[model samples]
Target: MPVYEFRCQACQRKSSFFVRSIGGSLSPACTACGSREMSRVISGFAYHKSMATIHEESGGPDRPGSDYYKDPRNIGRWTEKKFKDLGMEMPSQIQEMIQSAREGEMPESVKDLQPNLTDV
Candidate 1:
């Protein structure tokens, strides 16, 4: 389940709701004025820590898009152009594993561990 923030236009009230995905946004009628003219706010939920926060908590590898990647010592010997020249197709699972690692969640399997070898 995911929590979403919605704002009521009629009463100018904001509320958060834990909703099941019903294939669309959960913009309900205003609880105060009963107006269907509510507009969903794009932000304001703090239910979970962000990826950076999670990385800080785990004390894991450096963040992917940080200044660390800009260092010459951190640069990969084979660049993206080299991989493209090799005609390599990045596996979807490897992509997902890299994403997970970036979020500080390392999967405990041989295949999942491969991405950890690369500089996140």
Candidate 2:
């Protein structure tokens, strides 16, 4: 099986179509808006990472260090891992909050953690 990606001209959203063989034909429609006008785009490739590679880039979640939290991807990883360990899906709201924090939004509750600037 092969997957081909196309960008819908109408909505500018991407959609993928799967072909059973390399010679198969496809007339994929926009998944979002059902538009027939589509443009083929280069899709990102994926590869499998070995255990060693994963652990090396994992930033030592179990092992602690001052710099461990420097990477934004590392933030909320503990909560994510916890949810995964419990075999439960994280609520969309919490996921959104974590994503927002990763994108540098300060949560309202953490605003008080900031030092009083006038006192400096």
Candidate 3:
């Protein structure tokens, strides 16, 4: 089985079709506009990751002493890994604070976390 994507020349709309056999010819008709003049399109595909793999690579969010800011040396690498794992933006304030902490100047925002730091 193979999935093929097509784009309508008239309406510029894109549609996808899943064919059972590779030998079969695809009817590149635009579903939206019913246009016969369509072109096969390059489309992106989905990728999946298991939870175990994600946790292994991301250091699972619940793990203790695994805070990115715990060690000064982990400043840049940890922050990047955390943000990449969570698939979100690191707030500018937090980013600035991390940079400051990396430079030996702890920011006031994270001062309360000082006592929680442990030797990893």
Candidate closest to the true structure, highest TM-score: 2
Backbone clash count, each prediction separately:
0, 0, 0
Task: Write down the worst ten-residue block by lDDT for model 3.
Answer: 45-54
**Candidate 3 — which pairs collide?**
none
| Residue 88 Cα positional deviation in candidate 3, in Å, after optimal superposition | 22
Top lDDT: which candidate number? 2
- Provide the global lDDT of candidate 1 against the true structure: 0.54
lDDT of 1 by residue, 49-90 (tens): 355465564442333434443333333322333456679875
Candidate achieving higher lDDT, 2 or 3: 2
Q: After superposing candidate 3 on the true structure, give the runs of residues whose Cα lies further than 4 Å from its correct spot.
A: 46-120
How well is each residue in 1-120 modelled by candidate 3, as lDDT tens digits? 356778899999988888678778778789998998889886663112244455465453335345544567555555556677889898887777877878888767656434344543
**Model 1: residues >4 Å from true position, as ranges?**
22-27, 46-120
Better of 1 and 2 by TM-score: 2
**Candidate 1 — which pairs collide?**
none
